[model samples]
Target: MATLRVGRSVARWRVWSTSASVVVTEPDTLAVAREVVDAELSAVDRACSRFRADAELALAERAGRPVTVSPLLAELVGAALAAAERSGGDVDPTLGNDLARLGYDRDIAEVRPDGPAVPPVRRVTSWQDVSLAGRTLTVPPGVRLDLGATAKALTADRCAELVNERLGTGVLVELGGDIATAGPGPAGGWLIHVRDRPADPPATVRVTAGTAMATSSTASRSWRRGGRLLHHVLDPRTGMPSSRVWRSVSVCADRCVIANTHSTAALVRGAGAVTPLARAGVAARLVDNQGQVHVLGGWPS
Candidate 1:
C-alpha cells in the first residue's frame, strides 16, 4: 500500500494551527487546486474557528440571541450538531468554555506547554442547547460552541469535492490527518500512512476514490498543566480530557465527516468503542495507550 506518488502533484501549508495538504492526479491542475483548497479553508476558519474573535461562531456567541448566519456557517453548525446526535453526545460542540478553562483558550501552537493548574470549570453545556433553523442559529446565553470535532473534516470533504468538480481532476485534501478523496484515484488507490505519533507503529492503507479517512489522537495537541497532561479530546459528560484508553483512533468511511465523527467519539468512549464501531460497520484502527493496535470492521491489517 505504499503511496504511488509518481503522477501526483502536492501542495502543503498550515491552517487552523495544523498542517493542510492537497494532492492532485494532474500536475497541471495543482495550482488551481491549491487555490480552491485555500479558499475553502479560509471560509471554514471564518465560519467555525473558536479562537478567532472575528469568526462567525464568536459573533454569534456575542449576539446572545438568534442570529442569521451564512449558509456555510449554518452547514458547519448543523454538521457538528448532527455528529453530536449520532455519537449520543460523545462528540459535543458546546465544550468551548470547557476547553478554554483547561488552558486551551488559544491556538495549540500558542498554548503554553506548561501552565498553571486548570481552574474549576462549570458543567458542560449540551449540544441540544444550541439551535439552528434555516440560516438562523441560536446559542443559549453563556453557552459556547466549539466545532473542532467536524469542521476540519468537513473542510477536507468540501475542498476535495470542489476541486474535482471545478477542475475535472482527481483530488485529495487532508487537513491535519483527516483526508477526503474525489474523482478517480490512482490504479491501486490513494495510499495513506496511519500513525498517531512518530514513535507509534505506522501502517499504510489504500482507499479508492470517494472514500475518506480521519484520525483522532490523545497523543497530539496535548499540554501539561499543574504537572497533569491533558489532550484536546474531552469527554463532554465530564468536561475533562478523555482517559487515555486509546492513544489514537482512525476510521474510514464514505465521507470525512462520518469518519471524524466516529474517530473522535471512539476516543471519548474508550475501550467500549469496539462493539459499536464494528456494529456500525466502520473500518477502524485503534491504538492503545501502551501502543497495542486493534483493528475492527475489516480494517486493513
Candidate 2:
C-alpha cells in the first residue's frame, strides 16, 4: 500500500500496479477509497488488459472469430467504437496490433534499447474492423483491441462513483493524469496540478464540486523510435503517433470519462479541435508543441 499525505483534503494511494490516487474531504473516506480503488483496478484488469490471459479481452481474442464477450469487455469496446464514430475516427481501439508493431508491445520499463525504431508505417485496421452484435464482439482476423485511453478514464469515473455510493460521501479518483472528483471539497472545488509536458512545472486548476478532470497529452507516456519520439496517442487516420501539435490538453467536465473523451479526441484533433471543444462547452487548457497555451470555453479568461 503506497500512501502519501499530500494536502489537507487529499491523501494519495498508489494502486493497480499503476498509480490510483483518491481525494476526499472527510477523514473517514480512506476506507471507501481502499475498497473502491482495488475493485476498479481489478475490473479494468479483467476487461481490457492485454497482459492477462484470463482477461476478457484476451478471451475474446483467443475464442477464434466472432464470439460472445463478457459484459465488461463489451462495454469497453462499445465505448471505444462510439468514440471512434463520434470523433470522426480520431480515436480507434482497433490499433492494438499497430501499437505493438511500433514497439509498445511491452511495458515502458522492459522496452529494449533498440525497440524504439518504428517499423514501416502500417494501416489502421479501423474501428469498423470490430463488429459488435449485441453482447458479442468480433475483431477481424489480425486485429487487436486496446482500451488504454478509455479504460483508464472509465475506471476513474467508476471508482469515484463507487466511493461516493459506498461511503455516502464525495470522492476523487486519479489514475495517472486522468482524474474524476465527486462530492464536496474543502473549498468550493478541488485543486489539481495541470501540465502540458510531464516534466514541466504544474499549473493549478480548481474543479467545482462534483465535477471531474482529465488530462491527455502527446508528451507523456512516449518513447523514441527511429530517433523520433513515438507517443501512445495515436491518430486513427494515419495509424501513427500524433504529430504533437498539442503537447497536452486538460479538461474539466462533469465526469472523468467525459473529460478523457474530450481530451483524447482533442489531442487527435490537433489545431482544428479547439472550436468544437469550446462550442461543446468543454473547459480545456491546451499546450502546443511550441509551448503556447490556449484556454477553451470552461476556463476563466
Candidate 1 wrongly placed segments (more than 4 Å): 1-8, 119-124
What lDDT does the true structure give each of the candidates? 0.89, 0.75
State the displacement of the C-alpha of residue 152, model 2, in Å, after optimal TM-score superposition.
Answer: 0.3
After superposition on all C-alphas, the RMSD of every candidate to the true structure, in Å, is 1.7, 2.9
- As a TM-score, model 1 comes out at 0.96
Off by over 4 Å in 2: 1-9, 15-18, 122-124, 196-201
Clashes of each: 0, 1
Best by TM-score: 1
TM-score of each: 0.96, 0.90
